[model samples]
Target: MKLAPLHAAKAAIESMSGDQVLHTVDGHAFIPMDDVWVVATPSGPASFNFNNLPGASPELRQQIKDVCRALLVSAAPSRASQALTAYRVLIRFLAEEMPGRAVEMISLRDVLRYGASLKAKELYKLRRLKEHLLLWVDLGIGGLDDDLLIRLPDLETKHHEVGAAVRTLDPETGPLTDMEYENLLSAIRNAFTEGKLTTSNYTLLMLAITLGARPLQLAMLKCGDFTVSARQDNSKIFILQVTRIKQGKGIRPRTIFRPRELAPALGTLIQQQCDEAREWAVAHDVAPEVAPIFLSDRSSINMGDIGLRGHHSGKSMAEKLRRLLKDLAVTSHRTGRKLHLFQSRIRRTLGTRAAAEGHSASVIADLLDHSWIDSSLIYVETRPAMMERIDKALALQLAPVAQAFAGTLVMRQDTDRGRIIHTATRSQLESVGTCGKHDYCRLAAPLACYTCTFFNPWLDAPHESLLDSLLQEREILANTADLRIAAVNDLTILAVADLVRKCGEMVGRATK
Candidate 1:
């Protein structure tokens, strides 16, 4: 940016004496001098408290705010809070060590000392500090001087080995083993079906897990975006137009959106959610316009009580996901710990799954709606080796921990529960279990039942044969295609292993 325009903006900022609302290029407004600046952003209202930077002078606050205005005007709302965070760290650094000193008093030595003081893990923080210092110099705001400018270009030339994406490398972080994702997805469905998760939340979780859409994009979803497109494969295709963010300046943000296809069931659920959002808007006396799908209902899902746009912030989505995960407390067989759930983890898992399915970086980028392929390069680089070694002992060991089999054991010699849960063996209807809670199950019989809690397996039935068949199928698929595709039924394999162990123990005890 030219210093002339920045100076003119600074001049305009300096002229504001009383409470003044500054409008961002993105159509959001905030008072620059407020104790807590509640900036209305597409994601939601982000609050940055100047009081958090204690013992800071009004002059320092004004300078920070003035410099940030250029950022707010040009960049996305998400960057605004981050810029504040970077500023706070610098000001706090000055206040602690350099007492009674203005920000301008810091020399190149002070800059070097501050840079050295930061831990390696806070490399991003150090970068942010260096960035703001440069901006301050260029914009003529007070922070650092020209002496450090010579070393600034050298910092860019420093050699460093790049690390793989943490989410892809760590099993605990996710690219969740197919089994783990299946279990969590099942758990979430159960939670929603059992009256735990509301329509808004249930739909949001589905979209996140299924599409890997960012929370910012999801938050920006309006009721109108959930529209039906042309028919494909004899089925009506539901298209969700997700608003794009961080697309860089000069590109119209929300005006340019990516259309993502939703599964029929999820599409139906989202349509239902849109209905609720409409009702909610009417109940709240909010004139029906383009409104957010996930309305702010942290208090209650009660009609007329839902908060309007920017209420259900991206933070709100993250918090909701956190609470849901905490409530479910789903344990991971891989780590024997509750899965560390995050939206980013889910997004990473989506990318990893695509990569494992032999997708290129460009394909992964399109899947992730990334403007550049560089962001998705990490997933394709790291091999998803979560399912390479799944022997019987390993399966048995993790089986109990996974709790993948939610079915009840049917030991009796009767089909009295509801219906016979049977699969084919040697061209015969071989009964394995009973669907105890059978109310016309839409799931694939026998295979899906093993993981369901409703299935009651006959104790002495051909469960071992079932296990053998699934393992054989898994091996066949792995040899021919991706291990990710082969590992789709891994949870069921664990279930069958757990069942096999139980059946053997029960049969032996009876013989004894």
Candidate 2:
């Protein structure tokens, strides 16, 4: 019999069941015969091949491959991919450090040596490598034993401490400063005004800033996810239902309340997306209901097209943000800074701002979708202005307690200032050291006294010279181009000016 066409044969084979067997001679048409048994060459099953590690023995490489195959079978696709990459990195590192040695024979000392070769920032990778190795041992894919666990360094501790320190000092990775944030918002508004930013990009960026949602969550949002309703008070409320991709146990969706100010832009953007999505569905011959709200520009017009995936990937969304930021010239306000325009940083900026606004850690954790409260603590710790406010509140709270021990705290009538009362303690006056004039101390006498914490001013005090001196000193500092000195002088000037203003008010009242 003549052979069937290649496409036809493939179709027939695909339609056949695993139990049913068909034989073909000379790779032609399949013929069925029940009387005699005939064997046919089976096409090999598709398999993944790990790259050969340099300087690794054949046996060790085979063992690594076996473990990775086990991972591919047992783990989820994303996890399996990560495991494969992590294993390859570990094997490559091991191949260089301990050439020709079996993984089972890898000692704690060898692991430590491998860790030492990696930079501090790569500790998380090392930790992942350890996790994979442990998984391989548990699954019995490799000769590694439980003993290998003993040798692995405490990556969790090292990573935590180092990460905290880095987050505290590393300006690039942390949240945007107030000035930088304002600049970014201004740039975004300018971009919208100029029609340079796409509706999808603008909506996503706004959502990121306001809701602090991850890029993936934003990308995966469907048309049905957005909802607008009228409140009982006749005001419109815009609510976005975000699907938690990295959820555990139950599918708990998050609700993001769009601010009233952003509602108009959000509503307009969403309407545009719905129109685009419907058009895309019609173009691609797909159901309009199934189309994503945040469709990618690269999406194809047909379902069979290789580029038919409509939604943007998390990575592509981040890339779009980076390009937009670059175009806007959104550089950091801090020195030696670059435009850090990733989703996580934007989210972090929101979280940090919330923390600064006196939101509790638990509330922030809930907002950020953190599984633990500790994750939110980093934002709280990094906000110094918030800490200063907290410190001031605490000092006020402790004031009465301190006053109880310091005898009767009262305002004393001053000889120089007539009938003025000041909040002061005898202890404060006795313990606090006297001020000395340095090159820094430009303010003279009564004006300088207002800047001192120990020098409590009375409203009745003679402040004519103090006010004039403070104004003169401020003028002198303002005239100079030394910003640092001027800043310090400005603070002192404001404090003294406030005291002088209060004295004048008291004098007016006394006359009245």
Candidate 3:
């Protein structure tokens, strides 16, 4: 028998009520089919004018079209026919589901229950539909409901089981252990020291890690952006000119003092790059500014038989960085073969250090260029159990505790509360070599802060930055003072001790 026309079949089902759907076109009206067939179908073309729908908006229509497109792209001819049947089913269901209910009156609970009854993956698909509805609200689809969306239960398993499974993967995503951190850093440094990377790349990596620079920020650094000056004691201070800093909000600062070690390294990198560029310029008669700090070498430049200068701009530095990382056996989150040995290692280190230094969340947010302090808080995820203990112990304060153990330590008199708690400028700890405590003094040992009797100079940085003082004040106020020491037995000492241990642990992880 000849099949009925599709439009004729649809027209026949026009009179069907809320409980009945036009399953097949057979003339001017439609015929009802098995409920199971309706359940198996998913979508269809509208029988009535789509624009005539009671509350459809431009965005809602767009969403419907998108879903239709996705379905059409994946659907077979038979599946498409079945989907048409399902659309009819949905219309019938909606009619009976909420009679006379305006679009705004539809609640999340109703939508969720309807969705939850589907298969697991289908349930997720329905959730996507709900999200589309949310977008519709933004696009002014009727007067939308203001109630909060109820979270759907995970259809696959219980919450406890899911959490346990997640915890199993935590070691990879969570902060690295000290040894792992140190190994990663060492590997990256070795790549530089062994001459695997050019001077510019080496300098960039160091600055990026040490100063917590993002990839884009590191890429934008220029030759003139840094300065190194020699001190009278034959020491050098590196002053970094971070013109394109992410946190600077596009405005360059006049100058900022970087760590003392950066000066010489930067000088070497800059001079090498400049000297090479100068030699090249003399040979080719090119301008000095033409030599970008990170320009690709002519040999590596893919010319496709064309001259290197023609396609030189296309060589991506980020891609080169990724290749360098592979050479160093580093796993990267970035797409280009960029070295990630220090990306995670350095951020975790800085985050842990800044948090331990008693820097406020806002300060960290600024340093990290986080849009919110809440985002920065994610980095301060070390030693949770210890922090809880410290919080409780701090209730007793440190004055009485310090007085009780006075003679146990050096009992140095200092007016500066910071000096009592940490090393400051013009203080004994700030000096390089005055402590005659040991041949291998704890303070002088690399990555060994626990055995040190003196307050670590690094710890005193925040205090000096705050007070703007040169000398550590000398005053003894037993009534109110918390002494700095690296002992586990004392609570006040435990705080700093915790930091030292954590720092050591971080170093250990990088090394591993």
Candidate 4:
């Protein structure tokens, strides 16, 4: 049969409806098996068309569609898409060896020849083909021969796993170096403080940095998922119930989730974003209870399609995030270039940092939400990049946190009364240093003063107390929140640590 032309096919396309599948895109629908389906995937709605397989006979396409449509009911949403890829390869093989033959006509010899036709790089993809063939045969007699299904070669994929392990050690593609990680956190804080990063985007980056979660998991976040509890002192402990992805066959995000306690700083940022997202979602007629927190702002979106929208682009959150980081233009110390900020890199960094802190594989696996221990092995095996103290691993740079001892060291605790400046921190207003510049300034108060050349710090100020507080916060956040959050104050900690030493020497010398 001569297939329909593209222009004719465009106009002749038919639509179908299923509880899950929205429609079809078949130009030549020989059987009613739905050759092409536009289905709602976990991330968003997607189209999977089998019309590319024109070489596939009507019987073979029917068998393949039967297997895939059945899978749509029980398998993960990605399975249908993968089946398209695997079957397309089979269709390509058929065009060469057996033109337009039905499913049951293919034998063991034919299947072996198909396998041999694949290139080395394409071998892993064939694994899915063999599985698809078996599933096809199980559907009916109009499939590959039973002998081929029984005697199919099992792929030895240990080499693939080992290759993945080696890639995890790469600085550019895998785990970041200790200094590079530090710079990343510093840049995040700096960008946020400067208002270059928005509140929602800040929360997005914080989640990615801390949890190392995939983009789909992040996209699945809902407003109500963020819950709050209290500690003994009534400090609010925020818990984010993150959705799980890539769990296994047939598992959906809503079926499984893991709760993680967020750091106070991040909790504050996400709380602001939650209020904004929830307000927007509710005003748009979506049920408040089920409103998504990670929403997009595209004008073309219908009120009904807002559910599970990825980001501003109506595309994957991965692309949205990559664009956000690229827009922020976070520069790396290693290459002096804009950091790409890949999610996989964040995950590897998170894993390696956990391993460097003496956490076992079980702990690393739990932190990364890995389904198997083998996936977490690379972190344990390759931790040489992270040798810094746990608290300093991914330190966020302070706004003024960037420098140490830039201010004048005065001999006496007494200062020119008018020169002294007061700032509030931890709910208390205290005088830290005197400002040398009297003109109006918009920089963050005490932090900016520490590195200002015109500022003068007194010997009797509570520098030790501030240093202690910084260290304590960093230590707590590292364990409860994440290494990145704990280390956010690292530069400021170093700055304070330097000041304390300088003050001590100045005081001791004056007394002598």
Computed on alpha carbons, the lDDT of every model, listed in order, comes to: 0.72, 0.51, 0.38, 0.62
lDDT of 2: 0.51
Q: Give the poorly placed runs of model 2, Cα more than 4 Å off.
A: 1-49, 56-63, 98-112, 116-124, 149-157, 160-171, 233-235, 246-264, 299-308, 336-338, 386-512
Give per-residue lDDT, candidate 4, residue 386.
Answer: 29
lDDT of 1 by residue, 1-512 (tens): 23454566566766776477776656666677677766655455667777786546667776676677765655565665777787687667867786776554445676566677777765556666665566556567664446765565345422233334543367666567677788888778767756788776787788888888877677667787779766656677888898776675435446788888888899998888788778877876665446567776552221122223423566666777667666867778778888888788888888887887789999999988888898888878874765675777787778888877777676666557577878888678898878777676789988988877668898878988888888888888888976777888898899888888888778898899
Across 1-512, the per-residue lDDT of candidate 2 in tens digits comes to: 01123234344544665445443321211222122222211111112344445554556665655444333323322443455566666656776665665454445555566777877777666676676666555544444545565444343424425335325634677677554565576567546645788767787677677778776566656666666777799876666666664443212223332222337667767767777888888898877765678887753222122122476655566676667666766655345345667767777777877776778888887787766787788776666341112122232333222211111111334222322222223243212112222223333543334444335454444333444544555456657733333334333343444444445556687799
Q: Rank all candidate structures by their lDDT, best first, as comma-separated numbers.
A: 1, 4, 2, 3
Residue 497, model 2, lDDT: 46
Candidate 1 segments whose C-alpha is farther than 4 A from its true place: 1-8, 24-30, 33-36, 42-45, 51-58, 69-78, 100-106, 142-168, 193-196, 232-234, 249-255, 287-289, 298-311, 413-417, 479-482, 505-512
Better of 2 and 4 by lDDT: 4
- As for lDDT, the candidate ahead, 1 or 2, is 1
Worst 10 residues of 2 by lDDT: 37-46
Estimate, for each residue in 1-512, the C-alpha lDDT of model 3 and write its tens digit. Answer: 11123223233433445345332211112223221221111011223223433443445333333322222222221332433333333333454566774333344564555566566545554544443344333233232345523232222321111222112313443343332333345555546645677676676565556666554344434344545677999887765454323232212222342222455755676667656655665576655543334444542322221122211222243455455545766432212122344344455556655665567768776666555676666545332122222222341243232221111122123222332233334445442112223244323232223223333333222322212221111112222332211112232232233443334455577689
RMSD of each: 3.9, 18.6, 19.5, 9.9
Clashing pairs in 4: 395-487, 396-487, 396-488, 398-401
- Structural similarity to truth (TM-score) of each candidate: 0.86, 0.57, 0.36, 0.69
Residue 486 of model 2: what lDDT? Answer: 36
Better candidate number, 1 or 2, judged by TM-score: 1
Model 2: per-residue Cα lDDT at residue 42: 12
In the range 1-512, model 4's lDDT, one tens digit per residue, is: 11122223222323333322322221111233555566655555555676776577677666566555545544454666676677776667767665555444456776567767777776665566766665555444355666765676453321223426334465356677655575566566656656778777787888888988887777767777888789899999999998776786545666688999889988887788778777776687655546666676652233234345423322467787777766755445445566667787788888887887779889988898999888887777775532235232222232123333456777445556446666566878777777766654676667656645566777777876777777777677766875655655555565566677777778788899
Distance (Å) between predicted and true CA of 232, model 2?
A: 3.6
lDDT of 3 at 510: 69
